[model samples]
Structures are given as C-alpha cells and as structure tokens.
Target: MDVAVAGGQTATTSHQLDPLQRGLLTVFRSLPRTAESVPGRPTPLVLDVGDVVVLVSGTDRGSPATRDAVLDLATDAGVVVLDDLPGRTPTGRVSLVLATHHTAATAAQHVAVRCRAPVLLPDGRCVTPGPLRLWVRPEPTLTLTRPDGRQDVVLHDLHLRDVADPDDEHPAVVDVFAHPSGSGLLLGMTDGGAGATVALSTGPRCVRVPAPTTATLDGVTRTIAPGTYRIDLAHPPLYRLHAESAARPETG
Candidate 1:
C-alpha cells in the first residue's frame, strides 16, 4: 500500500496541499525540532505528538532534542532507517531513535535490533525499531592518578563519604569479561582489588558481547573474529519486561 510520509517541508500555501498532505505538513512542520539545520543540509526531529493519529515522530527535519515523535505513518510494507540518518543526530553524543514498530509496517533486524541493545546498524541500515533496546553504560568512571588511566563502569556512584572508615573504602575498580552462560552484567565480582563492584539498581545490566576481549559497544562496532561477539542481559528484574510489554504495541 502507498502511504504518504512527510518529515519537513514548509512555507507552502493551503492551495498546494490536499487534506492528507496538509494534515501531514501541519504535523511535520508545526511540531518543534531540536536539531540544528543547515541551508543545504538536514535536521533530525523527535516528537511525541499527542495520542491522535500518530504516536512517535523521530528523525525529521526539525530538532534533534525533541523526546517525542508527532508523525503518522500508514504502510503495509517495511521501513528501513539508512545509515545516513545517524549523522544528523544532535550535537554531543546522544541516543537517536533509529526505527520503531508501527501498526501499518513491519521491522526486522539482523543485529542490533535483535538483541535489544544499541549496536552499530550494519551497512548503515536500521532493523525493527521495536526490538532495539537502549543500553546505557553504568557511567564509566576514570581517574587520572593511576598510570594506566584505569576506567570503570561505575555500578555504584555513591562512595560512602563519612559512613565507613576512609582507609577501608572500596576503590570501585571493575574488570569486565565474558560469561558462557549469557549476556548480563556480572556484579559483586572482585577485580583483584580489596573491594568489589555491585548493583543495587533495577534496570538490567549489559555484558560484553561474547567477552570483554572482543569489545564492541556504545553504538560502536569493532572488527573482531567471529564467535567472539554476543550480547547478553544480566540481573534483569522481572518488572522491566513487564513494563516494556505494556508500552509496546502487540502485533499479529
């Protein structure tokens, strides 16, 4: 089926647009944009148009910061997000909605979308946005005092200031590696240090794809040997998927 999809085309009179075209233009142009635009370039927009004819409107010609998408799409076929879309993200590193599930369309992924983590969109193409999960690092902590420039995925940020003896505090150093069982964050494990890192949070933690030796994360893919990269979820609470299922639309 042919479905009209308009992102940003403005400065047009009413006479030039049909009822549907005009409606789309109004939804596309009237909504706020967060990304900066160049005269000869593009801007990415994310809008959460009120629950009307649409749900989410992402990667349009407006702004990059808008958290909600306000566009409507009706298609029986599939939609693909090309690699070029990522380049238009907002300044400073930020998460961009590459794809999403729509009632009228079907989306499938060969990599990142399948595992529900943010990985490189192979060949610059996005799969089913429905399955793409946002995996945030536990805020990598680094100190320059050490010669190695030791970095850590801070599972816990609050270092007991006055509660514990100053000398007995855990340094919060972490060493990540692979676990044959699954893709989950392994906490309470010691890094050969006096103290161990732990998780007291609710969200599921991420495990190195395959193992730490084959490092690839943060939307950045590394060229490594096969059988070395596999994404896993760790310590995922039961309520996470419960809430996730409620938010996602059901498809036949």
Candidate 2:
C-alpha cells in the first residue's frame, strides 16, 4: 500500500514517532512510503491523490490554507488519514479522527484530544503490538495419527501478553509450558518465590490451584500422573489447552 507521511515536526525518521504512532503504522505491513519535498515539511505532499496519509505534526506549523488543503485531500480522494494535527474536522472519510480543543472550538466540529491509548482506526478497531508472535506462536503443527483417526498438533507460545510488562517482579513472569492429554492438562511450570497460585477462569467459574503447597513435577526423568496438579497464579493469562466437558463435545 502507498502511504504518505507529512509534517513530522522535527522527526528525521520514522523512529522519532511516539509509541502510539509507531504501533498504529504496524497495521500496514511493508508499506511503500511517499516522501515529502523537505524533511518535516507538509508541502510537496507526495501523496498519490488517494493514498493513505499519516500527518504527524500539529496544525499550527502549517498555514491555515495548507491545513485546509490537507483536510480537502482527505475528503476528495477518499483518503484514510491518521491526523495528529489538531485543526481539521474530518467528515465522511474512514479516518480515526482526533482533534484538539482549539480546532474543535474554532470549527465547532473538529474536536480532538491527545490519545493516551494507541490510536484506533476510524472503524473503531486498534492493532495489537505483538503481531508476529501472535501469528506464529499459536499456530499448531499437525500430526496425523492414523487413517480415519484424529491428528495431534503441537503449538508453542500459544498464550502471550499484548505488550511486554516492564515490571520484572510480576508473578506471572516465569517460564511455563502447557500441553493437553486425553485425560487432563499438563504444565511444565517453574519460578515464583514459592511457586504460584494460579487462577483459571472458564466462563463464570474460577478455580484456584493447590491450597498452600506448590505442585511440582518430579524430575526431568519423571512425569507426574496426569491430573495430579495445581494452577499457578504467579504467571498470568495462563491458557487452558483442553476444554471442559461442557465446552467440548464428542466429535464425529
């Protein structure tokens, strides 16, 4: 896709964009960027009449005419604009519209605020930061067991956080692996000061693991009897591999 970047106040490169801006652009993969005539200048908009435009500067830097022109392009060419500039009001474009107090007051229409959260698309959807991991990790490798029989699949890094937690002390920050068996669940768990008490939620019901003692599997040489286990809370978003009886039915 063709993307036009204009008016990046002092940003010499895309690296200067704030986290939200960078996170927003990730939704588009390998985009062909159209460069402006000068660095940090809105002029010579290399936009192909209808390309997606991302303006990273505030409206004050540009002349009123220039700002209006940008807005006009957004409307005329059916452009999708992610406008950090605060002066223009977007009408009918699939733009994730955000305006500043001054622009909103001046136009009595274009009202935007500095978003603390990542900017979402006009369609009211936001992109998750961990795209590649989310895509590759959860994918299972299928193994055909027997003809007319079920195939077993193994997946790595299935459950993951949307963003990495800066806090190192978080209880759920331990190394853990999960897999399912015909009889029950198996977790190769580690870490947490005295192990962890995990809380598992299925629908409205939530279950806490081993009362006081941590459930530790024997040695690397030994495997615990299936179902003789506990949930560890220190780790978070602990995913369940096999569904409960109610969630899973006899398959044809």
Candidate 3:
C-alpha cells in the first residue's frame, strides 16, 4: 500500500504524537503522507467540516458482486464521486479523507486533528453526533488494468478498445469519466475525424484502453508508453461511489 496524504510533512503513525507533529498538524489544514491505511490499498472517502476520516473495510476486495453492490448504492444516492469534500460538504473545511478500515488504529493516515463519529470520540467532543451521511459519502473503487500492465483498483474508470479503425491517429491522452446515472464522456479511442464512433455502454463488459496514453480516474492517475499497457477488469460497472442512507459509527 502507498501513502496518499494531501498535506502534513511529519508522519505520525502512533496516536501519541510528539510536540512537533502536533504543532505541524495545527499549522496545516491537511497533510499528505503515504500511509498504508491497511495491509492493502487506498481509495477516496469524504469528510466534512467538523468531520474526520471514513473507514472502509471490504468483505470482498475485488469481487464482481462487491463492485456491483457499490455501484448500485452510488446510483441510488445521486452524489458524484470526489477526491475529498471541499465543495461537497456544507461547511467545506477540507477535513474529509477516504481511509481504510480500523481508522482507530490508523489516526496518522489522514493526519486530521479530529474525526466525526456518532459516539463520543476517544479524543473528545470536537464534532457533534448527527446525520452527516446525508451529505458525506465514500468513494469506493472499481478494479481495472492500467497502461503499464498492473492491476489497479480505482474510483471511476473508462476505457475503449477494439475500435474498428486503422487510419485514425491517436489522441494525446485517453479521456474517461461518468455520471451517477451511468452516462458521461464514456470513451477512450483514437482522435479520428468526425466519422469516428463508439458504442459507450455500462459495465460487466471487458474493454481495453490502448497503449501510449494517460488517464486520470478522479483521484488516481497513470500513463502508458506506446506499447507498454495492460488492463484486467471484470468489465465496467457504474463510475461512482457507494453511499449509505443510514449513518453508522465511523473511526476518525
């Protein structure tokens, strides 16, 4: 797992922080660090003003069943996936981050000063217990293959392969993202002339993103050389985040 911090310089894995780390946390709004939030990977979940971390622990890491369920939840919620909660939240304090399971053990992951949980936080009552889920949500990932032939689990992905055109020249980059209703700029093809066409469809379909391209899947980004690319996926699913209507207790 890699650290995905947005702001602090010093990384404090222990809940007990040194005076310098505590001072830095106060000085900065957020800090970026390569925290292995879990024994595995990372994805984006949101926190709001007076909010902290959203912990995600999956029963199925890369199972098709899990992906489908998450997609469906996002579709029903009608909120778009985001890197963090800058504009998505009402207070908008840039306090949100998508940390993995057992956040109580990984307080240094998000490096936030506080967390928003239903019960009284072990730290103190910095955040009120209320219905924050109506606005805050988690951005789950859809597993996909990247250009360099690696397995990548990402939030919101798009790819176009097997386009039946040879005369077309490649575009500088591949563009892909979608809305909650299963529609958006659903494509990854050559920059052909006006006659070019593609059958954009929803997931459980296998597709490839041809080489020599770069893609930015919301918070995740990658690039591939002319021939160095490979992507393995259970096909495409909805490009959105999973949401819960009922608020549950979360670790900060």
Candidate 4:
C-alpha cells in the first residue's frame, strides 16, 4: 500500500514496519536537533545598531521568521539593533535603557511592536521595572586632635544611604584615639578626651572602633590609616588638623 503526503515534503511510501521502527527512524532523521530544543517561551536578546544598544525581551530565538519580524519592526521604527544580551535571562523586567545615540525618540515605537517585555528609553525612562534613580550624594568630613600634639584629619564622604543614622545626633562627630601600643583604633568622646567617630567607606565590615578611654589617647602618639572617611559632627562647624603618624596613612 501507499500513503499520500501533502506539501511535497514527506515521501509517499508504505511498508510492513512496526511502530518502534518508525519512531526510531523519525528520531534518527532529526539529529543535532537544534531547532527542536529551542524554547517555546520568549527569550531576551540585546541588539546593537550603530551607537545604540536595545534589549528585546520575549523573543523567539529558534524561529528565523519571528526574528526577522522583530528586526523589521525595529528598523522601521528607527531603533538601532545591538547584539544578543549576555548572562542569565531577563526575568521579565526592563531594568535599564541607555541610549548612546539620538535614537531614543524612536526607541518606544520600535520596542512597542516587537517585545511583550517593558520598553525603556534612552532618557532613563522605562515601561516596565517601574522607576529607577541612579543619583548619589557626596560624603561628609571631620577632624581629630589630641592634647599631646597628635592629630589626624580625614574626609568621611560615602554613600548617604549607608551611613545615615537618625537615632544618633545629626552631624555628630565622635572622636576616637588609639595609643601606639593598641592593635586597633578605639572610639572616644569629645569631653572625655576620647577620639572622634570616623565613618568608614567600606561599611562596618572594615574597621569599627568603639569610643576608647583617655589612656588610649594620652601619652602614646596615635596613627590613622590614610584614606577618605566620613566624619559625623554635632554642629556644622568645620575643623582641621595636622599630625604625623609612624605608619603612612591612606588619602581619599
């Protein structure tokens, strides 16, 4: 017997073959099945065109037809096409949209038709992932002094969100002093001859010294690691100091 196949793609043949034999043949014909392994769900890809890079999410990578359709839509809308994105898949969020060229005006129009994912423009605008702000503020500075003519002054500039303390006094400076014999920098207070508080940039994970006793700051000279640090002060008054250290200090 013979079977008729449509589209002129399948052969018209019938033989005494079992179901297992036919299945095996079908599997053998589809070797290195790249197309079959492709995901049915949408994928994200980054396309670079000219100086602009656009991220297209929910795209069909396996199907050439679908890819061409997306590319056509993008070109018509004047959106520059970058390359495929790197790393893990985008979990349905358009985190950022940076425009290096003047293609922002057409970004929305192009992205609207091709992607079900949120569209972000070059002007820090996005259709998905809500609003995001990348703005950052400057850090604060403070000075430290000792009665033995030992002093260390450093800037305390850092990310405001990391160092802001509402419970503690606003603009408060906690001076800390350490003797040459101590292994760590100890915290001190203003009246008790304790050193001022020095805010660290690398967060509390780095060096965190509590207010130290007057004996820590009295006779032995104090040494500070040179680096930019945030100084919390009680009043808005600015203070400066000049001191020598046995170990070279870090500068910001």
- Go through the candidates in order and give the C-alpha RMSD of each one to the true structure: 16.8, 21.5, 17.7, 26.2
Q: Per-residue lDDT for 132 in model 1?
A: 21
Candidate numbers, best lDDT first, in rank order: 3, 2, 4, 1
Could you tell me every candidate's TM-score relative to the true structure? Answer: 0.20, 0.19, 0.29, 0.17
Predicted model with the maximum lDDT: 3
Query: CA shift at 73, candidate 4, in angstroms?
Result: 2.4
Report the C-alpha lDDT of model 2 over 1-252, residue by residue, as the tens digit.
112422221112133333333332333221213544556543321334465444443344322333344455456445655554434333433222222222222121112111111112211022232222111011111121212332212222112111112333343444344443332333344453576334333221112221222222211122222111222221111121110111224799
122: Cα error in model 1, Å: 18
lDDT of 3 by residue, 29-99 (tens): 22222223554454333322333333232232322232233233334333222222321222233233332
lDDT of 2: 0.28
Candidate 4 local accuracy as lDDT? 0.27
Clashes of each: 19, 7, 14, 34
Deviation from native of the Cα of residue 48 in model 4, angstroms: 15
Candidate 1: stretches off by over 4 Å = 1-84, 91-174, 177-197, 201-252
List per-prediction Cα lDDT, in the order shown. 0.25, 0.28, 0.31, 0.27
Worst 10 residues of 1 by lDDT: 237-246
Give the residue spans of candidate 2 off by over 4 A. 1-13, 28-88, 98-252
Regions more than 4 Å wrong, model 4: 1-53, 59-67, 76-78, 84-252
